[model samples]
Target: MEAKGDGSAEADKADFQKMIQGMLEKAKQLKPEELVFRYKGVLYPSVPSSVQTLQALGNFQARPEDLVISSYPKCGFNWVNLLLRDIAFINQNESEDGKPGVRSQLKLLEFENAGNYEEMKNDPSPRIYGMHGHYNNLPSSIHQKKTKILVVFRNPKDNAVSYYHFCQNNPLLPTFSSWDEFFRNYMTGEVCWGSYFDHALVWEKHFDDENVKIVTYEELKENLAKGVQSIAEFFGLSLSEEQIQKIAGRGTFQAMSDNAEKTHSSFGKVIFRKGVVGDWKTLFTKEQSEEMDAKFEACLAGTKIGAMLKYDLYCKE
Candidate 1:
């Protein structure tokens, strides 16, 4: 029996090595010659393992009660994620100190830790996972089970501006020489994670699906109380005004950043840069703003999602 167990262990080791080799090959295929990697139209950081994570997600199983906080990169994922956690355990008043809120409570499908896959597979009910993948690329089981998907979108213009700074600040990505170069790539969906509009549109297609709710970052920014209420409602959680206030207050960019010691994973300040609404004004030129406006109108026209968001790019004066 011991010999049989040894043989099984060896087989498992071999399988793991084979999986690593496969990931290496996938990395080569997906890694871009430019700043970041792009695989099947999805932009990933320069990290080869992230590419593998995305590939692995193709086969991930999802339960019906699972809550997935998904967005194209830089679309308030961390913010929404924390809000969900607060709502989930508001009464518990769980402090995320050594407890590590997000890592301990939530699952990230594209998490760098491969062990998370097995851990999540074994985790208990009502699993909540976060991801930064295009809507179409979501795990087949999520669609099959009609898992509850909470998607967040920022105005494409704001998203672009935020993304520019993120790519610049994130050491994992290749930094651009100028905002102009980044803008060009972003407009064309050539940057990591591809076009903002494309990502939004894909999720927009599923707006009518019972299991999906698409919320705008602008909406969250506009009224955190209302945002929290809506999120709670979607998850069938009834929140008192007080509970709503707690969740909203805790989930704010300022609050998250201030408590980075407890809130952030290893990457602290990088995750919480300039989480404001109209900061785009400082960055975009008049011509660039006009161009972005025209593009937003052209691409988002006649879509319910576009109508819902009103497609405005400027931070309101």
Candidate 2:
């Protein structure tokens, strides 16, 4: 029995190593421009995803009770997902040892293979997905079913800084030679998931959409308890003040970072770095700041989402 168990463990290790090597080889095959592949005018990361996955997403089905947390890369996608999962677990009275089981990972709608999609479809209802694509790229069933969507966004400057660091640390992502090059690419919508402005603008039109709710990283960081309550209400799940406080306490940046290894595995460090509002001040050059400002004004000025960004407070020097 012991020998069989040891053999099974060894085989699992070998399979894991093989998967990693395959991913590295695929990353090596991509040219800089090919790092992010385009499908239907939107960009997706080439590593860990394929055109087939995107095609599968086009015909993907969504249940009405399904909830989605959508964001551009590095825009609090993971954090918000954690909170919503906690809310769901709490609301459903699904707790183990008096604690909410919120560490389970949610599926990324854009990265799943056909088999995975089938698995998700067959799984129980109230499925939560983390999405990083534009609104139009969402599964048509999501729209037709009026699935509730939560869109999380961050100020562009801070988002770019975080995204740069993430790329540098994540082997699955292509790294830039310098922040300057990355900044230029980011401003032009060359990065994975395309321009942040484009994403914000498209989602902006849905501000009044009954099924969609928008939140900001800064808003959550400022008063997480309030954010938690708002999200609970948005999901039609009423929670007591005590429950909100407990969830917010567990969802803090420091708490999440400390638990990242257990919750996110090897990618935790790359995902949860200095979750602050103005880290961009340390990285963005004056010219880059001006450029982002110009783009924001042109694309989102006077918009509801623009006001939510609080750009003048957190973005400007």
Candidate 3:
């Protein structure tokens, strides 16, 4: 199937909207990327045009109050989304001392009010967004405004293993057999999203100036309470003890994976194989693990990112 020209028959904005509607009406006939809710790593049979339109519509300019969560695919994005949602809920109807409401934090969550990056950048007050885009690709306006970033990463081995499974089911990411092939691409930074080290380096380099912060899947899984609290402090929000428990409990891999399945959420890749860290130990041979570690060290040693990573040494007290 060939890509269709997005009908530009209309000269005016109103006419463009009409054509977009017409295109969207047939979007289901096209594919996921043509849909309004398309994410990367989700290919559409008819997508090149859709991708262009999406890029134009979703360009984020950034805001001083914006809270952007950046990560590669399968990098605890849902967990962070759930955490922020719960935090926002807790902050929604608090008492004078910022105590949480007795009712369920998520009970009233309509799950709307979030929009595309472009929409989010223009919104009043604080805006929160989760992105799988690389740092270099971020909008110039965002950099100009010095937008805050919360980054998340997982162990490369486990990340690769999970990515393999995800791409196996994903229309966008190629499903390849043999760890050698996958590792080759992964180490070369040619995998879907981008290189893990590059992503981590961008944050570490930018963190000091832009309020950029990082969290690890290992940390989030090892001590979820600390993870929640760490996130709270980073965002300059206070969480009650109860709210902490709720977010941590719900943000766990098991809980979030269950929620994704129950809600038929966008990140179904997260649910299919929500395995924990150290899965690398099971999946990678000793030589493979050592090879990856060597690559990581070669890529990031002595950098600020090196201080930020926990990797196989995660959970060391």
| Global Cα lDDT for candidate 2 | 0.82
lDDT tens digits by residue: candidate 1, 200-297: 77877788999999998888888888999999889887778867887787677788777653444334467678898777777788888888878877
The alpha-carbon deviation from the true structure for residue 196 of candidate 2, after best TM-score superposition, in angstroms, is 0.6
Worst 10 residues of 2 by lDDT: 1-10
lDDT of 3 by residue, 1-317 (tens): 11112332123333333443454356436444333233365322232234554355335456766666777766776567667756765755545654332211111001112243334444455666655665665656667787777888776677787776775665433356776777777777666555777777776666566467878777777799888888887777787887788667766777656655333223344334755766665567667777777887787777665666665484221
> What lDDT does the true structure give each of the candidates?
0.71, 0.82, 0.58
Cα lDDT, model 3, residue 211: 68
Where does the lowest 10-residue lDDT sum fall in candidate 1?
A: 1-10
Total backbone collisions, model 1: 2
After superposition, candidate 3 runs with Cα above 4 Å error: 1-59, 94-125, 266-272, 312-317
- Which prediction has the highest lDDT against the true structure? 2
TM-score sort, best first: 2, 1, 3
TM-score of each: 0.82, 0.90, 0.71
Question: What RMSD does each model have against the real structure?
Answer: 7.7, 4.6, 9.3
